[model samples]
Target chain A: MIVCIKQVPDTTDVKIDPEKGTLIREGVPSIVNPFDKNAVEAALKIREEKGGKVTVITMGPPQAVDALRECLAMGADDAILLSDRAFASSDTWATSYTLAMGIKKVGNPDIIFCGKQAIDGDTAQVGPGIAEHLGLPQVTYVQKIKEVKEDGMIVERSIEGGYEVVSVGMPVMIAVDKSINEPRFPTMMGTMKAHKKEIPTWGLAELGADEDKLGMNGSPTRVKRIFAPERKGQGEMIQGDDESEVCALLIEKLRDKKVV
Target chain B: MAVKIIAEECIGCESCIDACPFPGAIVMDDGIAKLTDKCNGCGACADACAVEAILVEETEVKSGIDINDYKGVWVFIEQRDNHIANVSLELICEGRKLANELGTELAGVVLGDGVEELTKYCFAYGADKAYLVDGPVFKDYRTDSYTDVIVEMINRYKPEVVLFGATNNGRDFAARIAVRVHAGLTADCTELGIDPETKQLMQTRPAFGGNIMATIICPNHRPQMATVRPKVMKKVEPDFTKTGEIIRVENSVKEEDVTTKILEIIEHATKMINLSEAEIIVSGGRGIGGPENYYLIENLAEVLGGAAGASRAAVDAGWVPHYRQVGQTGKTVAPKLYVACGISGAIQHLAGMQTSDVIVAINKDPEAPIFKVATFGIVGDIHKVVPLLTKKFKELKEAN
Candidate 1:
């Protein structure tokens, strides 16, 4: 089993200096994505049940090794990092293609698990795109892993309204949602073991990926522009002491706008 | 460009046969529609198909693409109880804008019983043309019946863009049509734009749980499809003098073919806090502490005569029902006044409520993102502020 993880800047905690529009990551700490923790937990559980190795893969800047180490401490058997300067600014399509090529180099496994979608990109496209690139069955928004069998696995998929139970053949890819399972804390012994474990780093050349499709050059979609949505018009504050009077004022305002 | 058809998987339901609007493009082959040379590669037939039989394949030329073969902006004018849904009207306003951008006509696809009078409303709302499909079978909102009639119209006249509301019925119909037509369908889009170069519809929406926004395009698919959330777009003001052509088509669905039954029509009594229809909302978050403090939220909501909402954290803490959660994982609300009490707005929570007309944040943390978006900020404890506000409102009412 191979679990893919990403180390995203803590966008929630980091403050952007209003004057410079630059992020302040100095005081902010990066934590594993809440959803990715579920993915790691799913992989660890599978490894424990099936007696196989769980390797964590990540493609990012050099600092992403910390995310891999966290995965290792969480009980992954091995950790691999795909770090290169050229990999920056990759869109979901390019990111998925690169990850797919790296997974190919790490020997085919019976299963692949990823967070339903990364917190930063939020495309949710990468997991499905990877499945399309790898030509394997993919189940997304998986809430529960009912059973893992030799030939296939049974899982419950989270649909819009409810859940559906599905069975897919082995060597399949599953993108899990946050509702899947609760992640466990890394033990002291496991943390010590991870500190001693040497992590192998791979580059684009070692992965043998098409350079054209591995970064911005390979992505078709472009972010033309991004700006905040326009704020609503000035609000009318109705001043009144009585409920009926306030209600009457609201009704009149709504009628003036013909919203009612 | 040539369109592909998956015949083996097709059920030969003839749903597509009735849906193809292009002349002589689709012919009956053992009750299933087959594409011929007359097919201009317009994808209305594929979208109208129900069993996922039709596939539209686009040919990539190094030079460019022709978008005029698919023209006009169409809004599915959904009606219930002889009244147009607010969402449908909202789409027409949006469609009118898109039509103007493309230098094309804006049209409305109205399908229901006694829909002739409804054409006037569509035109008044901004549609340049109205296509009506009226029959007794169309009186109710049934997926199969509605799909049959609408698909038949598309088979007759191909529209470039089709917009539907992201309501229950709209989503049900849109998904079935997109699958049948083999065209792309972008759901719950927050924004829409026309690619200046290709004249393609750029559908933008929050993907991966509101972490990021993605813009989707169906380069090859004809009649780029999308479903916009209600209240996300503004509805055009009705001009009573506006009028347009109403083309009525005969319905072909029989009562026997409908599989689902409308067992009962039970309407729940309107509640004081009708979140779906509320004009104002006062939401609380984890900072509210526990279930006991939810009373503070409820009291504030009651005084303001608004609905009470909770963040996902508060709801998951068992402090409130899941329906009250305001975030990416919950309902997206756009009310007149949104007061965030003790809610430190997470990105997910912001995605759901950021569109509120007026925002007021009351939190002890001055650095909260909710304060950034809020029109008015009170850096104080909600427990102290809410009670004060409630008491002030009461005193004001009594004095008046």
Candidate 2:
């Protein structure tokens, strides 16, 4: 089993500096993307039951080794960081292409796992993109693995109002949802071993990827601008002497809006 | 890929550090601004540079596709159980406006077994043309089969802009097609526009959990693809009198070629808690105190004839099921009336339901961010205020 992960700036860590009119970047901790952690947990569970080695891979900067180390501490057999200056500024298309190359270099596996989406980008495109590049069937938004078989497995994929049970063959890609499992904290022994582990860093040359399809040059989308969203105007506070009066006033207001 | 910072002009003011969205993307190395690998070339740091020390090289790479060949604005018409999904209709309504703005035709791309008759509904909604791919293999929504058909259709008759409903199935197949066709795809766009000068599709979406809004454009790609969540766009009233040109296409994908099989679909057995379709929603949060007190929320929702919802805190605490969660990680809802009880309105929570027509926040703390977006706010305990509101509404219904 191979699990894909990403390191992201914790969304809760993002804050705007009122005085500077800029993001307060200091003291913001970068953690493994929560959804990716869920994916790693799912992969670890499958390995525990199926008795196979789990390999974790990520394509990010050199600092992304920290994220892989954290995954290693969670009991992944091996960790690989595909880091290079050439892989910078990649959109989902290029990111997925690079990750797919890394996956091929790592060797064949019966199953591949990925998080539903990265919190930082929130595009949810990489999982499907990798599946397409590799020409593999994908079951996305998987909430649970109902039953595992030798050649195939039954998984519950989350849909609009509910979930659909799907039977898929091996060598398939599964993108997991947050509802799948509660990720475990790293044990002290595992943490020490993870610190001692030397994760291999693969670059574009190692992956044997085309330079024209590697980074910003290969990305189709471009950011025109990013700004703080305009704040909603101050809302009207319903004033009443008592809760009953407030409720009556609110009901009247709803009626005026034709909402009641 | 590199967002270069010219060290010769470095004033080391650290303005770029503050402006950079990614932490540790830019750092000061010996009183000179330096670029780290964390930079995704967003260019915010360059804009913030006072000394003009930062440079972002924007090299346009052509994907060998003629952009001029793509013309119409198309919405992928999604259906289940032989009924067209409301979100597809909503996109057709939106696509109509975009098509008008672009001076192009609006079309609907439908794929299903015997879904030929559904073209009339698409035409009624707003599409001027319908591309129908009918077959048994196209009945169920499978990633492989759907991507194979749609990618071929897109390559044959190029649409300048393709909009999907952002449903689970929508996101799944759309991503694959976008990658295969080498088109730029944006997810969960709240607003879309055409650049007046360049004629490019401008896609704006919330990032960092609604803390930032980024406008993206695919200048070099042929088809600009986007996925809009349900309830985010309005649908025009149907005009059954309208008719469209139906172009039937063949689906060559065989059942044996598809790798995954849908064994069963199990809808939640409980009362349908579809908050996106609900007119009103009453939600509780950390301030609701405990799981036992959740009945107040349900009672308020019942009295108002609405669905019950919960904040991430409440849902994370296991007080309520995940389906009833209303927030970024949960569901984005734009109801007529959203009553947030004790939900202090974290930015993530507000990102989901702040678009409601009427927002009522009931919390003991007056300074909660929920009040900022509320149409009516009560600075009182949910334990006391929720029941009173429920009682008052019950009495009003009885009197009526």
Q: Which candidate is the best by TM-score?
A: 2
lDDT, model 2, position B322 = 83
Tens digit of per-residue lDDT, candidate 1, span B260-307: 333323232324444644677889999899999998988877876788
lDDT of each: 0.71, 0.87
TM-score of 1: 0.61
Model 1 residue pairs with clashes = A241-B397, B19-B151, B19-B155, B20-B155, B21-B155, B21-B156, B46-B180, B46-B181, B47-B181, B49-B180
Candidate that would win on lDDT: 2
Worst 10 residues of 1 chain B by lDDT: B261-270
Best by DockQ: 2
How far is each candidate from the true structure, as Cα RMSD in Å? 15.9, 2.8
RMSD of 2: 2.8
| lDDT for each residue of candidate 2 in B222-295, tens digit (9 for 90 to 100) | 79999987777888889999998999886678899988999998877655476777878999999999999999
DockQ of each candidate, alpha-carbon based = 0.04, 0.61
